[model samples]
Target: MAYGEALALQRDLAQRRIDRSLDHDLLLLVEHPPVVTLGRGSHAEHLVAPKEFLAAKGVELFEVERGGDVTCHGPGQLVGYPIYDLTQHRRDLHWFLRALEECLIAALRDFGVAGERRDGYTGVWTGGRKIASIGIHVKQWVTWHGFALNVMTDLSLFDLIVPCGIPDVAMTSIQKELGERSPRDLWGRALDAVVLAFCEVFRQQAQMVELEAVRSGA
Candidate 1:
């Protein structure tokens, strides 16, 4: 889905959750076209590339309300937007963020990747290079705008911005680490791993709800 479309869906779901109309938490996994997003604390100078250059490369830019610095999203990146009610579990935001990092770390471990969390940072990293970026927002104790894991992403695109406002840090991907591996296959497996990890970490029963069922209020 497009980033805008996903954002709109998140808003709708968050509102439904706030109204107590949605009973189950949702994890939305999607791949977006090349785009750059600036979070609430993002500095404009972090965007190293010019607007014309970004436009020429078909990269869209949006200043978002999520908490973080500027970050890029594109094909081969697995973006997970978890619309969850913290009231059902723990209401502590710091614990929730750490849980998310742990969830990603566990998922990476399934693929033989050692993902770790850096001190004073909010992402999963390996060998000093970040593998995932996390930025979230909570409304009425419900969270949205979760994590972005670099699967087969083109790492060069990250050069356009000081990712998460961190300088001298590198962005790495699964494909980069596992050369000659099939990105399509790895992406599928990663999704499964993440879903399972999320369920286990949050203590929720996993259900595969069809989009049609969700739209129809079934």
Candidate 2:
């Protein structure tokens, strides 16, 4: 699905939480998209392209209500959607962001890429190029939208926007940074890192439940 649709689903999930209609414990999905998105509070000037140019390239540009500036998402990337009930955990955005960062940091470490959160920055970076981006929408203390780590994304699309409003911020991917295509079991290792990071950050054991469990009512 498109990033916009995914955002819409997040909004719906948030509303469900607010109304106390959501069921199940929590759910998460790892996916990849084919376009880029910029948050609503972000400046349009950060987008260096003319609308027609993006349209010609079959790239959809959208301004979303999430926090942070702009970032790209495309095939081969790993986008995480954690449909979590923050109320059940902690309702602190700082903690949530930190947990997400820890996930990327651990995931990258598995691939021998050091991912760190630069001071005053929100995403995970390696060397100087940003390898993962985090921006989310929270409603009534529940979070839906999450982070995207560049497993093997096409970095060219990021040139269309000054990512996170930072000038000359380099973008990199795992394939380029590691100088190797994803190993056959690369995703499994990344998933393990994600779950491990979540466990470490939240200080609680987590069970991987099916997406249908969340959709049934949550």
Candidate 3:
């Protein structure tokens, strides 16, 4: 999905949840074409790529309302936007961030990846290499703009920016951790593990509702 489309979907879903039109929280999963997003805290220097360079590469750049610095998104990355009502969970943003990390860590564990949380960092890492990036925005105790796990992402694109504004940062993927290439098999399993982890972490029996179901406000 395009970032703009996903952002619009998040806003619509967030509004539905806030207005009591949507009864349950949602986790929207999507893989975007190559793009760079600058969040509220993003710095111009962090995005080192020139506009002409990005345009030449066909990588779209968007300024977003999420709560982090510049980050790259592309194909083979599992981007999850959880439209969650913090009121139903904990009202604490810190707790919510930890919950997201826990969910991804657990999901990575299922794939034999030992994901860890680095001290002073707000994302999940493994062996000091970031495997996932998380940033969120909440309003009225409802949240949006969640995390991105590098399943098989092109880490080269991250060079366009100082990812999450962290200098000397290294990004990894499930494929890299496993030291192998695939027939694109692991992404499905990884996606399933993520959904299960979310269910377990949040204590909800989530059903996989289609996008149409969400679009129709069902």
TM-score of each: 0.96, 0.88, 0.97
- Over 114-135, each residue of candidate 3 has an lDDT whose tens digit, in order, gives 9999988899999999999999
- Which of the two, 1 or 3, has more lDDT? 3
Top TM-score hit: 3
* Top candidate, metric lDDT: 3
**For residues 1-218, could you state the per-residue lDDT of candidate 1 as single tens digits?**
78998888888888888898888889888899999999999988899999999999899988888999999999999999999999998999999999999899998888888999889999999878899999999988999999999988999999999999999888999888777754558989988999999988988878888766755555
TM-score: the better of candidates 2 and 3: 3
- Give the C-alpha miss distance for residue 1 in model 2, angstroms: 2.4
- Please estimate how well model 1 matches the true structure, expressed as its whole-model Cα lDDT: 0.90
Output the lDDT of residue 119, model 2: 93
Evaluate model 3: give its TM-score: 0.97
Clashing pairs in 1: none
